[model samples]
Each structure stands twice: as C-alpha cells, then as structure tokens.
Target: MTTRTASARYDGMGRTGKGHITTQSGILTDQYYGFNTRFEDEPGTNPEELIAAAHAACFTMALSFALERAGFRDGTLETKAAVKLEQSDGGFTITRSDLVLDASVPGISPDQFAEIAAGAKANCPVSKLLNAEITLEHHLK
Candidate 1:
C-alpha cells in the first residue's frame, strides 16, 4: 500500500496557535487550520477551500481517466468543482459539489460525455473522502 504524508508547523513562539501549512513534498499552502469559534468562525483559510481544490483536481483526473478508457482519444478536458459549505444541524457540511465540465472530444456524443462526467463525479477521490452527502450538478459542455 502507498501512503501520502504531509506535515504542518505552527508558526510563531508556538503560542500564536497558528502556523503555515506545508506538504511532505515541500509545498507551502495554508488551509483552514485554526480554532473557528475562538476566532468568530474565521482566522485562517479553512478546510472547505482545501476540500474544494482537492475535489476539483481529483474529479478532473477521474474524468480524464474515464475519457481515455472510453477511447475518446484524449481531448482537452476541464472541470470546475464547486464545493459548497453550508451550516447544518450541528456543524458545517459540504452540501453540494457542482462539477462543470467542458471537453472537446471529436467523436464522442453528448450522451457519452455526460456519462463519463457522471462516472467521474461519482468516483473522484475527494468525493470518496467526504462523509457528507454529495449532490453533483454536472454539465458536460
């Protein structure tokens, strides 16, 4: 099995209670990484934005795989995944993920494009990670 590891160091005198987020590969990126309620539900960029980025990238890859597998000849494909964070019964939930896709497959019909988009939407890695319900509003144009 393969595992991906990333680490973050809380910046400051270790008392500031906040720090910059980094990946194992030395990628410096910050996510929603602090106490919310203690700071009016806001301090640093939160998990939702990170989740949205992950989902968008993952879903795009999935769509690419599906397209190649379907013998679409690997055309240009782009996806915009919108992960909606909403207030729920207790905490916030990612209530919806809208995948807007645009592809240029010369021989594939619109129905086939939609099918591939749908499949990718259902099987994306980020989609699998979330415990909340997912509502995919996909448009393969």
Candidate 2:
C-alpha cells in the first residue's frame, strides 16, 4: 500500500486563528487557510477546495482508465467537483459532492459513455472515501 501525507499548523484559536498547510509533495508549502479564507471569502486555500480538486482529478483519471479498458484509445475528459459544507443544529458538516463531466471520445456511443462514466463515479477511490452524498452529471461533446 502507498500513503501520502500532509501537515498543518495553527496559531491562536477560533476565528482569529491562522493556519498553514504543507504537503508531502511540497506542492502546497505553508499555504494559508483559516476562518477568513474558509468562510469570509478571503484569498488562500481551504479544505473544501482541496477536496474538490482531489475529487475532480481522481474521477477524471478513473474515467480515462475505464474508457481505455473499453477499447477507447483517444479521448479528453474534464471534471469539476463541487463540495458543500453546511451548518446544522449540531455543527458544520460536509453535505455533498457534485461532479460535472464534459467528455470527448471519438466513436463512443452515448449509452456506452454513460455506462462507463457512471461506473467510474461509483468506483473512484475518492468517491468511495467520502462519507457524503455524491452525484454525477455528464455530457458528451
């Protein structure tokens, strides 16, 4: 098995706290994230944004491999994941993740494409990992 790691440090507490995140790959080094960034629309990255990016990438790659296995050699797939964090009676919770896909695959029937896309959405590692509602909408171009 393979594992990836990331670390975060926070100074202070509550809404005024300032946090920095660093990843094992160093793609994000000391990236800022906190109340302002997460809720106040200030500049910087947040956990939801990172999750969306990971979902999008993971779903797209899964779809590509599924297509290849189905005898498709050339295609393009673009996916966008929207993660929603909602406030409830208890506290805040991640409610759902919506995936939108635009694909261009030569010689692929609409039915086949739909089947493959659905399979990918259901089986992608990220999709399986999330404990939230997941929905996928796809279009063939």
Candidate 3:
C-alpha cells in the first residue's frame, strides 16, 4: 500500500480566517484558500477544485489502463469532473460528482467503450474514495 499526505493551516476564524495548504507532491506549496475562495469568486484553490482534479486525473488514467488491457493501445481519454457542494442544516455537504469524458479510440464500438468506461468509473481510486453520488457522461469519437 502507498500513502500520501497534505497539510492545511488556518489562522483566525470563520469567514475571516486565512489558510495555506501544502501537499506531499509539492505541486501545491502553501497554497492559499479560505471562505472567500470556496464560497465566493476569489482567486486561489479550494478543496472542491482539488478533488475534481484528482478525480479527473485518476479516472482518465484508470480508463487508459483498462483500454490497454482490452487491446486498445492508442487512444485519448479526457475527463472533467464537476463537484457540487450543497448547504444544509449540517453546514455543507458534497452532494455529487459528475464526470464528463471525451474519448478518441479507434476501432472500438460504442457499446464496448461504454462498458469499459463504466468499469473504470466504478473502480477508479478517487471514485471509490468519494462518498457523494457519481455520474458519468461520455462522448466517444
């Protein structure tokens, strides 16, 4: 098994607080994020954006491997994930993550492609990690 880590530090409180997030990969080094970034149209990154990126990258890589396993060596899989955060009595909850995929794989039937894509969507690590509802829409070209 492999492990990864990320850290966040917050100073002050609530909407006025400031935060910096850092990841083990160093791709995000003390990146800034807080209420303004998450709830408003402010610059910097939010947890939801990071989650979407992780889901998109993970699902695409999983589909690539699945395609190779199914004898498809050349293809492009592009995915976009949209994560929805909803406010409720319990604060905010991530309600769903919708994946949109654009694929170009020669010599594959739509049915076959859909099957493999569905399998990858169901089995990808990030997909499995998310507790929210997951939906996938694919365009095969």
Clashing pairs in 2: none
Q: What are the per-residue Cα lDDT tens digits for candidate 2 across 28-63? A: 999999999999889999999999999999999999
Q: Which stretches of candidate 1 lie over 4 Å from their true place?
A: 9-17, 29-44, 137-141
Spell out the clash pairs found in candidate 3: none
List clash counts for every candidate, in order: 3, 0, 0
Residue runs of model 3 more than 4 Å from their true location after superposition? none
How does model 1 score by TM-score? Answer: 0.74
lDDT of each: 0.69, 0.96, 0.96
lDDT of candidate 1 over 48-78, digit per residue (tens): 6667777888888888888889887657777
> lDDT, candidate 2, residue 55?
96
